[model samples]
Target: MKISHLQTRFILAGILLVMTTVVSGIWSAWTFAHLSEVAGRTIQKSQLTTDLSAVLSDALEREDDALLLAMSGDRGQAQKKLDAERLRFAQAFNRLKENLDQPDQTQALAQLAKHAALYRAAGDVLLTTVAPQDAFRWYYQNVNPALRRAVAACAEIRESNFRAMQRAGIRARDDARGATILVIAISAAALLISTLVAVMLARSVLTPIRELDRSVEALRLGDFERRVEVTSRDELGHLAEGFNRMAEALAEFRRSNLGEVIAAKETLEATIAALPDAVVVIDPDGHIVAQNPLAKAILVATKAQGAKIVDDLPFSAGSLRAVREALEGKPTDETRAELTRAFAVRLDGQPRKFMLTAVSIPEFQPGRCGAVAVLYDVTDFARLDELRTELVAVASHELKTPLTTLRMNLMLLGESAGNLTPRQQEILATAAQGCHELASTIDELLDLTRIESGQLRLSRELVDVYPIIDRAIISLRQRFEDAGVAVQVAAGHRPAFVLGDSVRLGMVFTNLLSNALKYSPRGGCVSISVRSDHNGRGPGVLQIEVSDQGSGIAEAFRERVFEKFFRVEQHLQNGNATTWGAGIGLYLCRQILEAHGGTILCHAGDNGVGTSFVLELPSPGTVEQ
Candidate 1:
């Protein structure tokens, strides 16, 4: 028979259920039949035994009454009554004898019949006697004893039958109970087995359906190689076979298009190889998927000796961070900004510079998305920049000695005003001022060069930052007064201490104070405050803020204000002449503070009146006594 999977399962389950029902029904019927036989036997035995006992008792009573009546009077009437009672007793005894089944009951019934015969003979003798006294004596002596013997025998037979019936009834009840228990146990076992079979069949059917669903999902996700496994010859098995065929066809189609894909990949590799820059493609997990020859050469040459390319590459930590960001789907601009910096690597014991660029590639499957990095070598440009800085430093240093000498000569000329005209003295004064300004600009340029060259070293000592701030304010007091700006110093009660070069730290405060004085309006206030705090980064930090009530710096220029030679546009509303400084003051301040592990930030002052320059310096650790 060509049974389907569903039909096969249903047939097995139905067979189990039907077998349980039929077996239980048969067992119940057998038990009921046995119980009915037991009950019928019990009832029959009880009725017969009861009739025998009642008839024997009535027969004895009737014989006693007849004997009493004959002894008193009316012998004929007594004789009739006795005959009627004997007839009834014989009928009951015969019926009891017919019902006797056990050996003991039959023997007891025979004995009872013998005793009844003797008792009837004794009664006949009493009826035939003419002497009334003799009849009475014979009835008492023979008939009474025989009647008692017959009654005892009848009781024994009835008791024997009743005991046998009781034993049969008990056996019947126990058999019925055992049968019911067996049927119930078999039914429960069948139910459990059927349930297990149904579950197994259900899993078999649903398993194929789930496999088909998974296969379809795999195909949708571009996995054409997935195939459904067929383990049966039923309808589900046929479906699995059809699915496998479809997957094979799709796989073949993919193979046909795979040639073009491989060709394109080779072309891309060739293009990347032809390029001068080093290029590497990496997956989302930071694994290198592909790399051009230049990239391989650079990474291999720059890696530590004996390190595998797969384990460690030559990409800088910053470059890797940019690639990771790209892989994480950050905007291209943000990734580019993070990567647009110079990376230095050692190649053949020589330093080489490269600029890294990371780009994210959109993926058909999001899980397969990755990034590509390109490294452009800029060693020559870096060398050129270094040379330019050195040249500026040398020129500034050379001009310093001559500019200092010129300033001293102008001061001497101004001092000897007695031998010259007032106009000549004024000219000397202006020239002296110009020489001073020139020297200051040269000094600032030299400081910038030193900082850039990494040649600046600090003479560190534990110093009070408050005094340094005070000294800077005192030095700038004259300038502050000349600008008609009030100078307020609000040093906190607690001393602020830091580990730094006193002169360099003072330079930071001086630059900030000078800018405040220069930019403040006439009669404006410039406040300098110092406090001790822990700025969450660490414990024990010294903070100094220099605020000026002047035209606040525009937000657009705030970031650029610390760049060397950058300046803010002057507005006519201020009615102040354009201030002159090399603009390196704040730049130098930033460099100096950073060298000492501190930070400087500028923001608009309260009420938007001026700019606030905040300095944060790490406080010196306390020494144990």
Candidate 2:
């Protein structure tokens, strides 16, 4: 129902066309009518003049005949002929005067009358006075020639009027044509003007609509900065102006919202800073962007600002190297390197051990480019760690002495009881078994401390990873069979050798295999996959993937699962679940991997329903010696 510019233009053109056509038509009609009347008058004049010329010619001929007869002395014939010609000439002259259409036409008719009367009178005089012969000669020579000349002049005047009328008709036709052309030209110009106006109006309407559309689109895309542009005072322009106002309102709203978000972010940062941990943020290029006060304190104490780990603090070189390796790039397993925390020697004291828990900062914004390093001051934890080491050391020594003495005493008691009852032998055997279990517990605890403190000495060498894997499986076979758990080795075609301590590597596999068996259901599969890095340039790194069907670690706890003493409540529920470990097991595994420039991580298993622990070790040249 809306009226478009084209329709408006069409209506205007129609109006102009009708007006021009009607005006031109009326003008042409009037001109044509006037030209017709003028043409009729010219025709009448021409006919009258043509009639007078004919009559005069006849009169002159008759007069000449009469005059000739009289000159031959035939008076009766001359008189009779003259009288008849006079009567005929008078009738012709009367007809000529009656046919004249104008007053000027009457003047030519009067001249014709005078000429005719003179010729008649002259003929009569000649008949009576000069014996008709001399008079007749005079009449022929003078009156007839005068009549012929007067009649020819009259004919010329009529012909001139006729020519004028012809020209007038031609002029009328040309005027009508020119009027029609003028009408057409005017119509064309009117149509062109209408078209231009219509186009301008359409643009006026469409431009604002398009601008509004673009503004809405930008708003949808989360850009609230756009506004509609309007240059008119029409309704559409008003709508555009309204749209711009709305955009400004929305922009103000967004600004207020963003201000709140910024405030909240600042509050969160402040809270994080208040904590005892030293937190730092790094750009993608490994440059530190933000640091909490604790970090600044540490940096000032060490004078290591703006310096890479390995370059700035040589005494703490390994510690800085570990931070770089951990936080350099992608999300990775937490890297823990042992370092010493130094204080000013106010009382001549040595530096203290502070366990460094360096974890690879995950990319907060998936595609954006930055990293975060949370530095927890584990000084107290380190002290506890040292206490645990000393306890293990002390307990090992103390338990060894008791275990050795108890074994000897149990052997003597069994030998003495050998000669007595079977009850005594049974009691002695039970006592020896108890002793053995207690000793084993002490040894396991000691091993955990040694791993945690980073004091576990390793003899690094090139050794095939499969033998260690095979040994682990064999060692844990009885435990698996007893629990009805199936254990198998999944290996690649080529041998995979790793530059690691075979004993420690075997222990890592054993710990993992034991966990897999304890957590898996009866007859469930515990697969150990081993392979070598295919490319030859790098070290022939070995990968060991241990998979088990068990309760999966929750997404939130995946990172925490490797922390020391960390245990999920579910894993501790089952009565026979040895999987609920001292939590130092996986921690030790990580520490051992880091020691050898290798890595380990826990993930959703192949079936995506269970857990898989993947261990990656340096091949050869890729290992940091």
Candidate 3:
């Protein structure tokens, strides 16, 4: 049963094969890493050139069109268009310059930058020329050639990247073939030597190994009674003796832990039973192992007819899936959220609510685990919350109709105020203003009810947001003019697109602008800025900020402004009748933006003199994720 001379040779061959494989694997990994790095760099350069080339070329064309327009005697409009296009071109060009560093790409970029500058200079000169013919002459002679050269240089950069990618691919193909041949050669060499030694060894060498393997397998299966026999004073003899001692030690340990394990089990059972909530333990195969006395109440409420506790549980499918995932060693978000929140079960025409939780138990058997679910009755507290929300919804609905009728009556009175004295008319106007504010509050209340009821639906489409903001500005133009507050919009060459309800998004912008106009002092300016950010990772972000030159909001009140029905008391009557707002506007803005996977924040204006409402929306469908 000992390892004789031939068996020793066979063992040495195995060790040699393993060593050879390890060294070969390390070298192959390094070679593959080098090739992968080369390919990655090439692909990155190629992709940048491919994406930016089209964008830069379009910008160049647009700039050329601007020059044409300027030569046709529309210098003012042309200048604006040219500025936008130049900004676009410069952004794309600069991004490309920073990312690409290969000598050819760098040289091509330099050429493109030079030609683009020359083209821009020529366009500027054409714009300055007074005579139309002179302008046209300068544009055709200088602008056209420079634009062509710039475009050609841009193409050269793309071509250089593409060529590099091709070279990378060719080298990768050759390297892959070499790596495959090397692996095959080493594998074949090891296999031949191992097979030769194994063939030379006899069947007698496996007798003791098989005996030791059976005993180890028995130990794995908890059969500590099994032991191996030693037949010689060699390696197998020592291994057999070691396995026999291990089995005996395992048996003795089990025997000694029996009383301790019983005590622990009783303690655990006592703890579970003393709980005020229902608890159910489930094993790895979805079997219901144990339950506390309180668990019967939950089972009865749920009418749990399934074989497994998880399937019969009252949690939603998503929560159940998360629990199953956890049991499989892949925890998920719902695992925590669902277990911490209240779950409801319908029973006998009434709802029973419970706060649910789950905890994973340590392994009781090899490679297996289980989980415990606890359900604490919270029916009374949950019902109170539901009733409160329902009461608000009902009250808002009931008050809306009556308020509308009263407002209509007030409007009728105002129309017939010709017969009244001046003081009477003034009083009537004040009452009407009060009615208007009441109406606004009622509308906000109705909106709040819909949001609470989960009935706020968005009629979504890919909308060009510039027009929406333009309309928002137009609707409030007279109020801003009356306040003597100048308005500024930073328009761009491209449309800012987002997937959202146009009307709702417009409301958000209108609300922010209205707040700006309301807070701005006389002769101050309100500025609206829109910018798109793309980082080549996912869909781009669209940011819009509305700022004013009024006393800014206090830092302590900034975050609180977005809470429902919360407002700055000092600003309630800070301005004339035209400049007041209900606090729910910003709260609703936050809600609507959150529903669209976006966010809104309040910050100080650019000059720290007024409030800025910043809205960041994730653009949809334009860029790959």
TM-score for all models, in order of appearance: 0.72, 0.51, 0.41
How far in Å is the alpha carbon of 51 misplaced in model 1?
5.9
lDDT of 1 by residue, 1-625 (tens): 6456767767877887788778777777887787788778678777867777778767867877886787778878987887888888878777777777778888887898898889878877776754675766677688889888987887787688778878877877787788788778877877787788778778888999999999999999999989998877788999999999998998998899899999998898899889988888877676777777767777677663333332365556766667777787664432223111467777678888778888887681466567888888888877887787789899998998888788777777777888998888778867776786577678778888888878888999988776887898887676677678898888465556688999988878878888888888998998988777655456687778899988788886676677656667542356565775666899898889989998888899998879999888888533323
lDDT tens per residue, model 3, 189-282: 7677666656554344577789889988988998989988776566677778888898999899989998899999999999999998888888
Q: Rate the local accuracy (lDDT) of all candidates.
A: 0.77, 0.68, 0.78
Lowest lDDT 10-residue stretch of candidate 1: 331-340
**Given candidate 3, what's the lDDT at residue 413?**
88
**Candidate 2 local lDDT, 1-625, one digit each (tens):** 4443445645765676666567666665766676678667656666666766577567757866876687778878987887787777677766766665555556666665666567656665666665543654676676667657655655654665466566666876786677677667766776676676667666756777887888899988988888777665556667878888888898899888998999998998898679676666665556666777766666655666655433343234444555566655544444433322312211124343333444565563464455555656565666675776788788787888878898888878777884867887777777887786566556666766676555778899988777888898887676688889888786465466677899888878987887787678897889888766647664456677999987777776776776766776544445454445556677677878888889898998876767899999877632222
Report residue 435 deviation for candidate 2 (angstroms): 7.2
Off by over 4 Å in 1: 5-26, 29-44, 51-55, 74-118, 128-130, 166-235, 282-289, 300-352, 357-373, 387-441, 475-490, 493-495, 513-587, 597-619, 622-625
How far residue 596's Cα lies from its native spot in candidate 3, in Å, is: 10
Model with the higher TM-score, candidate 1 or 3: 1
Deviation (Å) of 200 in candidate 1: 6.4
Locate the minimum summed-lDDT window of 10 residues in model 3: 331-340
Report the error of model 3 at residue 555, Å: 20
Ranked candidates (TM-score, high to low): 1, 2, 3
Candidate 1: C-alpha RMSD after superposition:
6.5
